[model samples]
Target: MERKQFLRTLGTGAAFALTFPCLQGCSKDSDNGDIEEIPSGVDFTIDLNSSEGAKLADNGSFILKNLIVVVKDLNGNFVAASQVCSHESYDQVRFTTNDGGIFYCDVHGSRFDLDGAPLNQVDSTPAKQLKIFNTELDGQILRVFE
Candidate 1:
């Protein structure tokens, strides 16, 4: 599947590994989802909050829409992850660091890197990477593809 479509289906830490095609060996930081063709046409960009009328606070969260997306890590390295958890499939949590400092899972004890590599996990739990979508920023508009 393509990146953008993966985002809607997978969660943050469960995307990367589960999505990469022709991957070498599977590990904790990645998933083993099967390879299927991403639909021919799908628009993954959801303006969670438009920057036009909304004010992006210097230290607050302000998005135009609620359709979550995978933005650039604080370091600007690009990686799109599903906001849900592959382990739990819950959509009520997230991992955010304005400074790109850490990936914190609110529901579970999972924490990962900016690249979704695991930093820690619960005992014997199956590790999964978030589903990632490929993206492009057009001026101020982000064009996400699956």
Candidate 2:
């Protein structure tokens, strides 16, 4: 390969390694560096039907077990799945993208639908899914428990 092409490929590989540290390339030469992320659990109940839910109706984010919790839409009837990109894991706090279509990873621009389906880019990056918790509405509150 040409110098520029090789460098570009290297950069892409490096970026992929950084984003998904659990991947293969990142496993090599671990003697030089180690990033140990200790997981801590968190719990939160989102109200998807009331003003409080309305207040947090868009791209609302919470953290649990170092896993990002993102809230997309709650139309008082049902809650929309938070569009979390599995590729880049670019979940923001208290903000939702208006696309209402799919979530995009902030790092490599990988896209996943509301159901967490990968749209395009990269064979190494799997077109898998994200977590979708059960939501409930009782009286005036829609609680996403457990």
In model 2, which regions exceed 4 Å deviation? Answer: 1-43, 47-52, 57-85, 88-100
User: After superposing candidate 1, which stretches have Cα over 4 Å from the reference?
Assistant: 1-42, 46-49, 52-69, 76-79
Please provide, for model 2 over 1-146, each residue's C-alpha lDDT reduced to its tens digit, 9 standing for 90 to 100: 59999999999999987878666555653332222222223235555464555554444332222243444443323333333334443342122344654455544556655555566774575665644545565764555533
Return the TM-score for each candidate structure. 0.50, 0.44
Q: lDDT tens digits, residues 1-88, model 1?
A: 5887787666754766566642544442354222333223435553425653133222223232232335445555444545554556
Tally clashing residue pairs in candidate 2.
3
Q: Candidate 2: how large is its RMSD?
A: 13.3
Candidate number with greatest TM-score: 1
